[model samples]
Target: MQAPVQRQCSHVSTCELFPKFGLRGSLRVWQVFYCLGNFEGCARYRLSCEGRAVPASLLPNGRELNIDALVGKP
Candidate 1:
């Protein structure tokens, strides 16, 4: 028997937010839930498909992240 194939977001390699998901343990859920799981539900993926610009701070859930605040930047 063959193992089931895993479905991942095609934009994972080009998505700016992809690399940031690994920096913190709490952020891993995004990768598991969106990047690897239900990518169709991801806001970034949706925007990309529509030919819209995806902000670097945009989360998969359609929430904008204040990256500077999280990273302690001015």
Candidate 2:
């Protein structure tokens, strides 16, 4: 009585989990993120599968990274 793979949602828009199978009941790893938009292109913000050390561009508004939103203690 389990769900199908495609129907599963182990990944979040910000970060994702590996092991497409066991991911059903496991904690996801922490992957730090940088600003998405840049003077170049959005693809530049994309992370590599290897998770290598790459320089990322930081944004001022970061319209996405609303630190206050993350700290949901209200």
Candidate 3:
């Protein structure tokens, strides 16, 4: 018999298949990143669904996260 399917949550934190999808919307799209190490320490780095733009505070390890450079022309 075939196994039953499961539904995934829209939230980035609780979902395991988050990487398979892009953080897309009418204003902007963001690449979903999963922190493999130190989940507690990297809690602040997780992207928030509250805004269209990528927050500078979400930067991890002082690395430059340029959203404009990553976005493609529509």
Which numbered prediction scores highest in TM-score against the true structure? 1
Clashing pairs in 2: none
lDDT of 1 by residue, 1-74 (tens): 99988899999999988878887778889999999999999999999999999999999999999987656579
lDDT of 2 at 73: 34
Per residue, candidate 2 scores C-alpha lDDT tens digits across 1-74 of 87743322222343322222123332222121222213122232333334643222312222333333333335
| TM-score of each model, in listed order | 0.88, 0.20, 0.29
| Number of backbone clashes in candidate 2 | 0
State the RMSD for candidate 2: 11.6
Model 1 error, position 29 (Å): 0.7
lDDT of 3 at 18: 34
Ranking by TM-score: 1, 3, 2
Q: In candidate 1, what residue range of length 10 has the lowest lDDT sum?
A: 64-73
- Locate the minimum summed-lDDT window of 10 residues in model 2: 30-39
Q: What is the C-alpha RMSD of each candidate to the true structure, in Å?
A: 1.4, 11.6, 9.1
Full-model lDDT for every candidate: 0.91, 0.28, 0.38
Q: Would you give me the overall lDDT of model 2?
A: 0.28
In angstroms, the error of model 3 at 1 is 30
Cα error of candidate 3 at position 40, Å:
3.1
